[model samples]
Structure formats: structure tokens, C-alpha cells
Target: MRDIYSNVLVKQSLTPAVRTATATGTAVDRNAGGGAMFQNALVVVTTGVITDATHTITVEDSADGTSYATVAAEYLQGTAPAIVAADDSKTYELGYLGRKRYLRVVSTVAGATTGGAVAALVVLSDPRVTPVVRA
Candidate 1:
């Protein structure tokens, strides 16, 4: 049988929290396991209990880990999501195919009075090392 869990590592880019304003996710080091170790990445976003707000999700990349820029459309496998109250209890995934070593997810919240619960996870795969360590 094929084992998917053993070859990949997952990290939280955005901690689960109710947000009322714009939030920039934590930088996920693509080389955390090892230098240039991972060849693929996917950002997964989950939402819960959305209120009177609109949330827009965008993915960004950085080579130096400090300076980041929005990822171009050509390097992304799927479109970033613009979430609304109707999108509550939903999930979205975007694949990153750029060469940057760091990645993050950003959320732009608007017209929010009660805010929304949102979170993001970065899945790193195609590793040069086996059996990724869980932290």
C-alpha cells in the first residue's frame, strides 16, 4: 500500500483564531526539515462560524524568509479564495509550485463585526528524507 503520511510534513501557517481584521500568517520554512528538502507544498484553509465579514486568502513566498511577496498566478495550482459568510464551515486548498524557500498565507477581512474562525496549514511533500518528523 502507498503511504502518504510518512513522506510528508505538515505545519501550521495560520493558527486557528477568530479574526476581525487583516492577518498575516507565520512563515513556513520549506527547508525546515532540510535544505531544499521539499519539492512541493499545499496550503489548506479551514473556516468555522463566519459572521458578517468577507475574507480573502492570498499566498505569498520569500527567498530570504524575511521579505515576502505575493505569489504569481503562474506558480500557483489553484486560485486563492475570497470567503464570505456563506462560506462558513468550508475548506480550501492551494498548491505552491514556486522555488521560494518560505511560504505564508494572508487573510484580508472586511465588513466584519463578529469576525470569523479561520486557520491554515502548509503541507510539505516530496521530501529528500523519509519519515518526516512530527513536531
Candidate 2:
């Protein structure tokens, strides 16, 4: 049995050059799967000018990146106040159940309108162990 250390496998910022209503969030390829490297994989997201309240965010996965599936979903709503601007960022954590190389985030609500603009931030990380066994 192979043992791997728990560390940040990948990290990236979700910044788009052209600000659009429909924009692809951050994504990362694990490239570590087969036996158990992906068994305890964890995904963490950090938002800026975005809050868990008033918006529904999710972490999606896909083998081909083009087609994706919702690995985990979270809806930020409750007693917390609505997130009006992109100044206060929130942190979200999620764990991967199955094997997936590609992962990304999708925002249902783009927050409130500010000067006719909407924005959101997403950070994705995949932490896993080592030594994946093949069938």
C-alpha cells in the first residue's frame, strides 16, 4: 500500500478577461486517480466580493471538461444578509466522493447589480493522497 501526504495538489484563481454574465469558473485536473489517490480528495473554494448568502454555488466535475456533473452543491441562504458587492469573500469546503479529474464552480445568482455590473469569485483546490492502484 502506498501512502501520500495531504497537501494542496493544485490552486488557481478564477479571473476572466472579459466580464460576462455567463463565464466559466475555476477548474483543476487531479490527474491522480485509479486506486485511492482520489478517495479522500477535498475541494475548497474561496470567494471575493461574493458571499455564501443570496447565491447558490456548486462544485461540478467532468471527465471531458465539456460535459460536467454536479459533484457537490451549496445554497447560501438563511439568516445571513445578502451579499451586495464583491468585497467580502467567503470560504466554502467540499469533498469528492468519486474519481474526477476536472472540477469547476457554477454560480446561480450573480449577486446584486452594481453600476449595471455583476461579479463573483471562486477558488478551487484538490487535495489527495498518492499511489493509485489500477484494476
Among the numbered candidates, top lDDT falls to 1
After superposition, the stretches of candidate 2 with alpha carbons farther than 4 Å from their true spots are 1-7, 16-22, 32-39, 50-53, 72-87, 115-135
lDDT of 2 by residue, 1-135 (tens): 333323324444244222224345666555533322343445444445432224444567788867887663332222222233442555555555556666665555553332112232322223344444222
Could you tell me which residue pairs clash in candidate 2? Answer: 35-133, 49-86, 49-87
Each prediction's TM-score versus the true structure? 0.93, 0.52
lDDT of 1 at 22: 95
User: Model 1, residue 88: displacement in angstroms?
Assistant: 0.9
Off by over 4 Å in 1: 34-36
- Winning model by TM-score: 1
Superposed Cα deviation of residue 6, candidate 1 (Å): 2.2
